[model samples]
Target chain A: MNKYISIILLLTLLLLPLVIYEDNNSRYEKLSKSLLCPVCQGETLFDSPSEYADDMRSVLKEQIDNGMSDKQIMDYWTARFGERINTNPQNSNYFLILFPIIFGLVFGVLFYKKVSND
Target chain B: MISSIGIILTWFGFLNLILMCFSNKKNLFQTLVRINLFIHFLLFCLLEVGLFLDDFSLYYIANHSASSTPPMYKFASLWGSLDGSILLWNLVLSIYFYVYVKFYRATTELYDIKIFAMIILFFNGFTIFSSSPFSGCIQLASIGCQDFTLLPFQDLVLSEFGRGPNPLLQNHPLMAIHPPILYFGYIGLVLPFVIATSELFNRYKNENWIKIAEKATYFPWVFLTAGISLGAAWSYEVLGWGGYWAWDPVENVSFIPWLLATAFLHSSKTQIKEKTLINWNYVLACLMFLSVIFGTFITRSGVLISVHAFSNGNIGTYLLIGLLIFTFLFMYIGIKNIEYFKTSRKVENIFGRSGFFVANNIILSASALIVLIGTIYPIFYESFFSRQLTVGRSFYDILVGPLLLILLYLMVFSTKIAKVNMNLKKWIIENQNELNISLIISIFLTIYYRASYKFVLTIFGSVLLIIIIGKNVISKYKKTKLQGSYWTGQISHLGIGIFAIGLVLNVTQSFSNELIISTGDTVNFGEKEFIILSPYEEIKEEKNVINLPIKFNDKEKNASLNIFKNSSQQAISSPAVFRNIQSDTYITIKVIDDDKFKLIFRENYGIFILWLGLAISSSSFLTRVRK
Candidate 1:
């Protein structure tokens, strides 16, 4: 009984993503969070309560209603406000994110090898 | 006159520390340390009295406090700015030093005291010479005080009435306690580093230092957890943003030390039990201390753009130099005594308790490194590429999220493994029933809620972790009555599981909407209908508060804004929260006109669970300390 229940739960979890659909509201939230409020310090558009953020949110709503893709909407903001508008680093700076992971992997491997060898 | 006394005491304390570092006689050294501690305690008390008395002759009080400020806020005003905060830091450091000398002196050598004294002397010197709270306007004039108009010899009163504290600092009661608690945590980290570094320098081969260092780390680790949680609660309550934990530079820097210290705590356990990872524990202790200095630099130097950052000053350069000196010193000692702590024991099995500790260390260290990189990347990028960039929450969420998930997975399984060697298949077979039940509950909840993929995964992992911990705790309690360390460790891990669950639910299910409404206007969102009642104003001592009462469903709540009656006319918002076990209805009001107001209504789910988890996790330390 436990094995069957575990298998069923595992399968359901694996297939759960397929059943989840993205709506425009969630997309709008995602877009607003991905963009920073230019007027506020360290606040995203969704989080900032400034009048400028309100206007930007309205503009974002309009763009989403006009059926722009996520990339296109992102590009629209980045082109207007430079690359700093987007929260994620640029593609060229991907190495900055990978540096720590690679370092952790190397350290783990070396430590594990030493311990296992002894 | 009191300000002059404070200045004299600060100088005396500085000199005392310096003398204590050089004194070879143990009696003289102890005397000097006691005097140093006494002088700082006197200085802090003097500063607090000045604040409470509204002594405008003192420059810091005149700038930070007003006569009309409440007694609680007046007491808190000691750390309301940079200079006074440094005084608070020094005072806390003095207390820690006294406690160490009085209690743990038997385990420590004279050389350790000297090294620790040098550190104390540096900080004391920094406090006195660079950012003295005792300076009056006349002394401040030499440092380019823009508002100074008096002659050097004239009575250095700048204002008959003070300016009061920062509006944000005075806005919440939690501000009174958060900084002091956090300062204690930050300053307490130095002891472990001092112990470890001194041990390395002395070429001590015994494992007794590990016990002392681990004990030193536990209270600070608990305080850091509580401090960070209080800070998050303060942000959520006072910032009117309906969110906690923004992954800001200052916040990240605080968390970096915490993560490293937590890693040290876990690995130090392995070192004590199995005599492995001895060098790793020392490195972690040093890194934790260095990270605290780096965090202080990031917060005080104005190098980062954060709401929590202090004003830019020359102290940044001094702190950076201090950091470099300490880093070089630690690296030198670490290299010179690297072979002293080399372990000869082997882990015969990768699936055992030791491997789990190793994996835990790597995951936590990686998480800290990723956060550090995300935090300082923009600074490096701008300096090197001449381009401005913002590494925001998404950067951290993308990189550190998977690492945390892996950590949770390890926490779930690691407890079930044997100490030295374990048969993985037998362990799995033994825990199959519990595993399946956890999966079923998690999946059922996820399906019922229709959560996103990331949310689903987090919920699953958290549920599994909680179940494993709960089972282990029950079985262990029934078997032989759980040990102190084991009990505290399991409870803290259980708290993490609950915290993770609360975090995911709050992030994924929470929603906020803004509406423009006037008096007598009714707005509807979802099933709840909110009617704006008449707004009223109240005069509260130093400030005027405008409260907008709204009736949502069956309950009435007020979202108020405080307008301080100072020259600056600073306004702060106090959001109204209708809270329950499952969710909170948070409302913040912004007055556009006499009758018009813009309000943001946020429904935050599982916030109570988050606080509950923090309470459990932090309180476990108290139990262990008692034991």
Candidate 2:
């Protein structure tokens, strides 16, 4: 039964993108047209047929088909490039940066107390 | 000469600020700040005009300028680069510097204000000299480095038209307003730093600084929220994702500061309630400022390449130093004044909303920090290990999702929990009255969409939020609408709830397709179908595009997708939908394969609520004028 469920899950995952692939592409197309290409300053990937975006699109299409998930793809890229390929960088690695954050809060609280007391 | 003048003006700003600090003269700081402001304005005009006039002799202009780039874009290009953006930032800073000084001139707090101005001036001056937006571009040929500078005007190498703006930015009008609004929010944060320092120096500690800072903070926080919302709005309309906020790097940059500001707001509430939180308030202010620096770093450094980032040459070292020195100065001042943190307040109401508000700030910061780490880890990786790693949507969703749900839960219950000034027993009894039955009904109404199998989990999340909002609204209406802050909070929270619902719906129910279908072509999707009747073409001075109207027949209703340009041009979906009722749909058709065309269907609801949230949150500023 577990094996059957696993196969079913895999199939379902595969089918999900098939159903939504068109939607994803339209979304990409719309977004590509609207946002500036980060790699190429002035042109949109939608407007300019650059090889870089073309490669990214192909990779995106493959990921959609593989249904490997965003984490898997991100992990793969992290492995391939280290940590900078992420469109959104998370602040986990240098968590110590928050030391300043903590200090700021402490100071803010102190300032509030003294002001309110007066 | 202009650069020298700018340096002199910066020194003048510093000088006036210094005089204000030591002088016992009445309103000395105010007078000095005003003088400094005039000097800075003249300097800014002197510097920017060089670029605005396309004086290629100036390295700043040459690097950013191109022959084919239009005059209008040239003007916009002033802020299109990092050094320039920072320059404009100081210009805005000077405006606020004088205005704040002038407004508070008669007030007893002068030394604190002077310190704040001095700190800002030092940081500004250091960055100007180091990063120097006017720094002449290095000759790549001479240096033997490949030419990488984005020349603004250039002869079309392949076509008559210049490569259009990031397809994302050029795709919509919202792009124009979105960044500036975010900038306003970012800059507004500097004022809180000044006020916090002012309070510490005054030794006249009271709710006054919190009260003043709360108003100052809320205006920008509100603008920041609106700015974020409009970006999402632009995304939904222009990106064809049927959703806003892609969890992209640029979006994350806007979001992080917003989260810190939110924490600052909630912490202020704690201060107002128990007149304490000495350590915590400083932390929140510093976090907000840090977020501003971090967000700017992410955008300008050209380190994190994403659709939302603008490409100026590498500015990592410049950004890091600026962030470091500013933070260090604030830390020194705050720690030096540790005498002010003697009294600690008792947690009178852990079961109450005030406690919950503190928890909310914690959650907000934690989530923002997680995003911050994921966003910048690659930079560290590249700098140290010579490796580049990238984190994306799934990482954030998994990490922050549970915490956010808890936040949502707190938001739901906060309206019911009374504290401090409220008569809790009587308030509860009144809330329990017959009027609450309507709330129960509305809560059920909020759930209706989620109960449907066709709907997603976010629908229920939205419903839960709406229900909580319903309870709060019903309770508030029972009381008078006289308190502006209370009403403002009400509208703001309600708008947030509505926006939450809209966000969930947009993310879940949106539809997209990319294909090749032309005029008179028909494509069927799920329950909806699109028929392309005709194609229309439009040519402007800068843009050339085709417009097509497609008719949609779905479970919702018959709608049309207005799409133009696919292979040769950018795709634009002109969704003709207008209403605040929560669920609205727009359809656009893009011709990809001639007969096999792409169709995009999207639904955006609750944006009107987002705007309403802006209205209510911004109203907190009105309290400044309150008698």
Candidate 3:
């Protein structure tokens, strides 16, 4: 009886995301507002309220509606605007270099604790 | 009378302070130090009134004072302007210094005392000489204060009406008091700092300095907490900006010191275990002082533009230079003197109080660092890369969200998990009944808060807060309630918990509507309705402003709003109000119509929680004071 209950709960949890799938267009449309245009100094693509921003938003909407994923759209933007257009720093290079060091320092402490305890 | 006396007393104190510092003979110098403090108090009283009184003979009075200013503002106006404010800041420090001496008269810590005096002198000299409030007024002719060009003395007010303080200040009660309290709190950080620096040169034998500075430290800690909260309260009341802190550069200046002070207080517990986070503690103390200098520079220099009139004059560049040199010197000293504290103390457990404290410091510092960067990032970007940028909610909300989640988790678990040299489950088992009750209630509250967030991550935050409190509530129950320091820490952390809950509610649920409406018109907002009535008006004899009242009808509900304007002008600025709500419905009346009709409506998710948090946090201080 417990196994049945636990499995049922697990299945429900696993299936929740599928049921909650947001429209692709809506998700990307919201995300694009926070991203900056590479050519602009400080203005976000969604912020300009200009012809270019309007055009960009429309293009994004079309692509998203066609079922392109968030990552794919992001990749497309990176190619069009170069990596500079991205609001967050790319998860490569400096961030990549720092990530493992941070992981190591954190894990190193735990690793040392485990070894010492044993 | 007060004007001259303030100067004479300050200099006399300065002379003795110098004597105390240079003359190493312990007996002779200590006497001089005592006299220095006495004179400093007199100076404080003298300048305090000059700013407080409507005495036109005093230049500070002529500038910052107006007879129309209310009594509380009269006290508050003492630190209203640049020179007068520095005087207020230094005087507060002098009082702290004096209080420290009185409290520990029996202790013979000579080097620390001398170093403290030297630091006080430096602060005093900066206030008195460079940008002295005691320094007489400039611009007698300019801006028509005295009509500097022709017969300046004759033009000056003998009892003539002068311009009152900024309207924003006089409008709120918190503004009148919060700044000065914050200033004192900021200045108070210097004492522990100077003592810590002195400790580097001496043997670590004197644990008493921390004890001596304990109450003095808590005194400021309480005030700083009050000051910051009051600042938020003031904003919530007046600034129409619903949020208390905007991550504004100005706000960040005060927050940086607060973070450091909190860290210092937490880590100072290391003294109990024969081990210390000496380097960390020293850095915190020094960093706090650095934060004070940075705030002083930022406010005085007008690097960031705001309504604070204190940020007037050439003080900015000098303050910036002072900040760079001072920070460098302090950091250099800290790094160089690190060898003096080479006692390698192992952190006992990952879940212990000290461990939790270390984590707390990291989170706090990280928050402060982000704020610091975002605050000054624009300037650095402009100077270095010639790229100008504006950091807004996008920068703060997203960046801080993850950290806040982490902090909430830590905060909840910390109290539960961080037992200092005590048996945990054994303690809990004894008080399990109350512990379980508090735990259940906290969990319920967290769930409610998470539901209010409208996001999944809020669940995590809520759980964190519960863990933090549940652990501590159990511990506090086990211990005697009369334990002063122990109780204070627990109560304060409880205040923090309540405050976090409030912050979560406030941000998630606060609802506002911005729209235009004329009088006698009805507008619909969600299921609620607002009937716009007429504008309310009043004029005070002593002031140059007309106050208009707006009648608000929120879904057949009646409310009133007061819109203020400069008397000389036909055009007016934003509206002000004393707001009230029924059943979480926000009813506000703003003037949006040309016939000056009232715009009124109800908003969802009231910020009552914010107020609750502030009240709870501030209550701890009274408890602290009483105990």
- Among these predictions, the greatest lDDT belongs to 1
Which candidate should be chosen as best, given DockQ against the real structure?
1
Taking the tens digit of each residue's C-alpha lDDT, what string does model 2 give over B10-31?
5565566566567776646556
Would you give me the overall lDDT of model 1?
Answer: 0.79
TM-score for each candidate, following the candidate numbering: 0.94, 0.72, 0.75
Which candidate has the highest TM-score of all?
Answer: 1
Docking class of 3: incorrect
- CAPRI category for model 1: medium
- Candidates sorted on TM-score, descending: 1, 3, 2
The order of the candidates by DockQ, greatest first, is 1, 2, 3
On TM-score, the stronger of 1 and 3 is 1
Instruction: Go through the candidates in order and give the clash count of each.
Output: 0, 75, 11
Model 1: per-residue lDDT, tens digit, B399-465?
Answer: 7888888898887777666353556677667888777777778777776667788777888888888
What digit string (tens of lDDT, one per residue) describes model 3 on residues B98-200? Answer: 7666664334557667767776677676655555545443344321144211112233334354455555556657766788777777788876766665655
Q: What is the DockQ of candidate 2?
A: 0.12
Candidate 3 local lDDT, residue A57? 65
Residue B17 C-alpha lDDT in model 1 = 79
Give the higher-DockQ candidate: 1 or 2: 1
Is candidate 2 or 3 superior in lDDT? Answer: 3
